[model samples]
Target: MRRKLTLKDVSRESGLSTFTVSRALAGAEGVSKESREAVLRVAEEMGYVPNLAAQKLRGVASSTIAVITAGTSNAYYLDMMNGIQAVAQDMDQTVVLTDIAIGGVYDIGRERQTIQRLLEGRVGGVISTLTLLPESVKRLEDWEIPIVFVDSSPPEELPYVPSVTTDNYNASLLVGAHLQSHAFQDWLLLVYPPIWSSRKERERGLRDAAAKAGATIEVVEAGNNAASASKALRDCLGRRGGRLPDILIAGNNPILLGAFQVARERNTIIPDNMAMVCFDDFPFAPYLDPPVTVLNERSEEIGRLSAHMLTEIMSAQIEARKAGKPAAPIYTNEHQLQVPVDLVVRRSCGCPDPTRSRS
Candidate 1:
């Protein structure tokens, strides 16, 4: 049988102390770039795999981080994960993804347990898309790991963790302004419950922009699916003397998809009966019946930036610990590293249809 691959093999092959070899492979980042490459190369040649669980037993960092989100079903979430994955690959960090999609009752339980497992493994850090359990936040001080939150509210105003997100309010303002310039009078904002930060902020922005333009605005709430949104739309139209909204701002991509379904059911003409826009852009947005006017949320960039932030926080925490100082975590606000948004105008907004009008 071949000899077993171990840290001793890496240390001997790389002329570095076992500790240095360990740090290099564990993503500690204190070792010089040249030294890290040397250690990693020899370990790879020797087929030595660092055991993360064993490292945790020795109170050492794992070269892994966890990224928890609702699910991979949502295209927006998938884009965010793609961004995070790109950064993770560059940093040679492994990512653990946990999907919570059963229901609210089960989600809370799963999120907390999954986080606890990651903590016990001594993951280098964590980047979560909210849905983290309150208990996890309360016990974060004990974990002492670098943390980053994406598209969610930070817990208890903890100023140490970083957040990566889009400007929901301003994105909404762009949509409202576009409609106002078009002279669309009656507007309807169809969204899910306003409990979500994205929905609440976008609604506020829409209201502000509409008020300034002297356009009438109405709000309607839809359940999580298209069927509910369709029913809601039909009910609104029946109550309004069969008149349709001049403009419709769907709070998110799924909601917009639902609105489009409702429009089809009602046999309404796009931009002739109603104009439509969505808060977040989708992959196939340009191929729709009337290419959609979308407020691009930069979802992928949010994930990429959050990963970078976590890497920075992990580095800082390691240095502070090495210097025997308090590991003062860095909490970057949306202002410090906020992602920008763009409003892409297409045929759906009652503007001249680009396909036919451009030529």
Candidate 2:
């Protein structure tokens, strides 16, 4: 059997320190051009190949992008993850998915712990699906770990952080208008809490629309999962003495399912008995009994854009560090973008097949 060469052998032949040889072999910064060339030449002559698995076992930092998500059961995340994974695969980067939700609910203690874990792991970058606490955001920034928020934003105090999301306010307005077109006077919005941050803009738009149309809108808060949403809807209906709202606006996919479950338990028909609409478009949205009206927020596109933006920042940071420059990720106005949404009209909103949308 032939002896497998090592960095030590390259170091012995090149007359460079083992540390320099290792850095040169990894193509990392801090090695001079001439030293790197000599190290490469010696390494080629010695037939030394870097072992990635061994490097990982030795606690070396990895270029793994972390995607922090809440409400993992929501179908919206599946398509979003697909988009992020596609970008990561193309970039030859690995992705780690971390859910801060415990028992299908977002927990502050878990958020704090997750942040510390990622920092300790020395991850290459992060893509968060919710607005993290101010302290968590601060800690990540202080560590120079590039982060991109997808479907969310930075803390209000850190307005310059990069984010890619839908224009939720406008999307809400679009939803409200379609509902108003059906002459719905009483509205009910079943939504998750502000931990997601998107709830704020979405509620604001709906509120404004309700006021403009002189319609009464009731907002119901629920956990970010289907079970909680189902209970919230049941409770709200109980308080209303079983009086269903003119139209029900679901916050997301999970909430939508919860609403459907409640409707089923009561033997209620959609549109005729009570109309329905939701924030996100899922695979089964159009295939349901009556189909569903939805605000197509383009989740996959948002995910892809967020990952691309993070990778670009990471690349820039690497180049800067290589040139002995400040390596913090550079963010600009362009880094914070909101993709427009389209209203996909289906029969659930009382629209006929001819009135159905193509979005």
Poorest stretch of ten by lDDT in candidate 2: 53-62
lDDT tens per residue, model 2, 167-198: 98988988888877888999999999888899
| Local lDDT at 221 for model 1 | 87
CA shift of 326, model 1, Å? 4.7
Flag regions of model 1 displaced more than 4 Å.
1-61, 101-106, 131-134, 224-228, 238-242, 323-328, 332-336, 355-359
Model 1: per-residue Cα lDDT at residue 216: 89
TM-score attained by model 2: 0.82
lDDT score for candidate 2 against the true structure = 0.87
lDDT of 2 at 266: 99
**Residue pairs clashing, model 1:** none
